[model samples]
Target: MDIEQIRKRAQEIWEAEGRPEGQHERHWQQAEQELSGGGELPQTSSPAHHSATTIPEGRGKKKSDAVPSLGGEPGGFQPGELASKKK
Candidate 1:
């Protein structure tokens, strides 16, 4: 998402959460999730993705794990690419 979208979503989250303290980053993260289409449906996969957690039936919304940086990609990376590459 862009700066404007992130800022807008972050503000929305901050306000929704009653404006808690020490959670600016968290709010920003949730904002990205919101503006970046976090709630979009994910396709069911094969056994490899079996272990992946699925959102509950009534709780299909996806939440962001962390806040992206102000600029650039915010350090996006795969968790197990090295191990898989060696195989």
Candidate 2:
């Protein structure tokens, strides 16, 4: 790919990461990999242009179905029971 494109993408990746210190090489390599079709790069956008369109449906909804009930006991253990039982 183009060196200029890699440079631009690296700059974007650096900025998107909050401009951390001492990460130039890492960002450059990541940009190169993404540009070379190694992986998809995260999309960056201005706050004004960011909207719900970028988020999937039920993005903020709590997924109760994914959680299993523990019968009101934390970790499914009684208050005085040992965390690990001996054989």
Among residues 3 or more apart in sequence or in different chains, the pairs in candidate 1 whose N, CA or C atoms overlap within 3 Å are none
Q: 4-74 in candidate 2: lDDT tens per residue?
A: 99999989887986676777887888888988998775544334345534768867676355544554764
Query: For each candidate, what TM-score against the reference?
Result: 0.42, 0.46
TM-score of 1: 0.42
lDDT of 1 at 1: 56
Q: What would the per-residue lDDT of candidate 1 be over residues 25-63, giving only the tens digit for each residue?
A: 866776777677899432223233344566558673654
Specify the highest-lDDT model's number: 2
Off by over 4 Å in 2: 40-87
Model 2 earns a TM-score of: 0.46
By summed lDDT, the worst window of 10 consecutive residues in model 1 runs over: 40-49
Q: Give the best candidate by TM-score.
A: 2
Error of 1 at 33 (Å): 1.2
Segments in model 1 whose C-alpha atoms lie over 4 Å from true places:
40-87
